[model samples]
Target: MKRIVFSAMAACMIVSACATAQDGTGLSKKEKKAGWKQLFDGKTLTGWHQFHAKPGSTPAWKAVDGTLFLDTDAKASGASGGDLVTNEDYENFEFEYEWKISPNGNSGVMFGVNEDKKYGATYSTGPEMQVIDDAGHPDGKNKKHNSGELYDMIAAPKFYAKPVGEWNKAKIIKKDGKITLFLNGEKTAETTMGTPEWQELLNNSKFKTWKGFGEYPKGKIALQDHGDKVWYRNLKIRQL
Candidate 1:
């Protein structure tokens, strides 16, 4: 069944091509407006990819009551892995999404990913925009669990996360080697990518053991399911 579905999709892609404009991460006014485009239509997963295990099954992600929900209940049965990635690849861009985590839930949004199934997660190559329950999760005690942190690596500028079970806004801008994290309309963290300093940091971190992490110039965006219920919506992006 999965093969049949993927074959049909493959057939369609061969017949038609869909292109989206940029997210305008660091472009001038004219260039920004010219390339800025949306990735989600607010209703479907037309441009995303599920993990390798379910190559042909519909993603566990779904729209419920106008919001995107990542169901973890069904995941325990036979989930290949917890990464769901965008069908499109991006270089530099600004991405925004609203999310709500269940009490004690843990999840993440990653970018600058060079997706390869050999690795355990999207984080293997992409820097994650930490999504966690700051008031309930174990990592909450640490700054990395905050709303805008870089997930165990770089801390967010400040704590701005709402209580568990409430929706919070988050954004990530990646461009020209610089990365910025924003939460609920406030800037929280900023860092450089692919720099000697960053490499040094990775060299001393868990990612140090992972091969090809952040080696690609561009790749897909991804969502994680860490055995927690997570909700997302109003996801939009513009390239630069």
Candidate 2:
């Protein structure tokens, strides 16, 4: 009788906990139980660093009001900070984050980014999930360059994107060489890497000129600084 009562009480507590998860904050208990780790603590850039900022200089990125933002106007002064990258490398994983771009802003979230002196830019290596103002940015003119698309490689099927300054959720799932992209609760793109289909896409795109662009089976994730103001938060990753 005591064991039955204890079990009932635990179930009730679990239900209550799931109802109160605060979005854009730290990971929930359920997420932690499922092996999810917080990439952004909502206050600092602890696990990330400037991708190519000059030695011993601070990146032109800021964390404010629980959001990480890049100042595009400041970056235009030639004090460029480049992109931001995770300190750890991941091979197959699920990554989710929320972002909002200013009017006419342009940015991207990249994975499979390799850090080598030979690579002049992060997009040269990693595949980018383009982030831009769907209606305001010039890239928005092209379906393939809009938010949640695979940046000139694959167009996101569902073109549902919120307006500027409104937060939008995006997800990237890569496991066993199959990659999937999600934007605002909709599946945007899906593809498999290293296959002939992928090869053809690579051949058609400009990335073919760059060696080993998306061939890496493992690499760091990156947030782009495309000389545009952008805000990001609620970064969470779970290894699959």
Candidate 3:
């Protein structure tokens, strides 16, 4: 009987391990083998901070229920809710995250963001992967500004974002000057940086006059506050 009980306990342990491996906030065995690292840790804001915040300022973003979410109420109450940026800069990497936006909300995930006092906003230096409620937000009417597009540079061929309140999977991969964006398992946009074509697109976009927009080869990743409610989870990255 003792032997049988020991075997059952071991089985339970195995099941628990498997369940943990499949947790949304954790890396799977395969993901670990492939060198994926969890960025958010599903608990605390350990490796992130507000963009251009003074030293020791508390971030207005919250981590609860395995989500990193912007506290819009705090912003509405006049709290300093700036864009959140990764503590570490990444170059030539793949980043994936899940996001859920409120009705008529707006937000974005930006890469190559230069955190400098000279640049007043995160979008000033980094290009954005647009995030919004496609069915509710005014920006949704412009395909270039819809969720998953490369901000105003390239438009998604078709709407690929889920409705408001539903989580959508988003991925950005940048390698060797080429970047690709994916939303809900569909490729939304792709562009090669530093090319004449890229320069032409930039010249035609709103960022044309912005001195350093989309010019960084290595910079921090940012999550825009946009004065809107948004939640993000499962943020992971793999360096290329």
78-159, model 3: which lDDT tens digit per residue? 5678999999999899999999999999999999999988999889999999999888988888759999999999998898
Order by lDDT, highest first: 3, 2, 1
| Residue 185, candidate 3: alpha-carbon lDDT | 99
Which consecutive 10 residues in model 3 have the weakest lDDT in total? 16-25
Find the 10 residues in a row with the least total lDDT in model 2. Answer: 19-28
Give a tens-digit lDDT track for model 2, residues 1-240: 999999999999988878657555576766887889989887888999888656777677878898888976665575557899999999899999999998999999999988887888888889999899988888799858989988888987668689888999999999987889999998888889989988887887878888969978899999998888899998999999
Q: Give the TM-score of each candidate.
A: 0.79, 0.89, 0.89
Tens digit per residue, CA lDDT, model 1, 1-240: 999999999988855432222233322344345665555656676677775545456556775876778877665664344677888888888888889999998898887677566766677788788888887888788755566787767776678888889899998888887888889998877778778877876776667877777677688888887878898876778887
C-alpha RMSD of each candidate structure in angstroms: 13.2, 3.6, 4.2
Q: Which candidate is the best by lDDT?
A: 3
TM-score of 2: 0.89
Residue ranges of candidate 2 with Cα displaced over 4 Å = 1-15, 18-25, 76-79
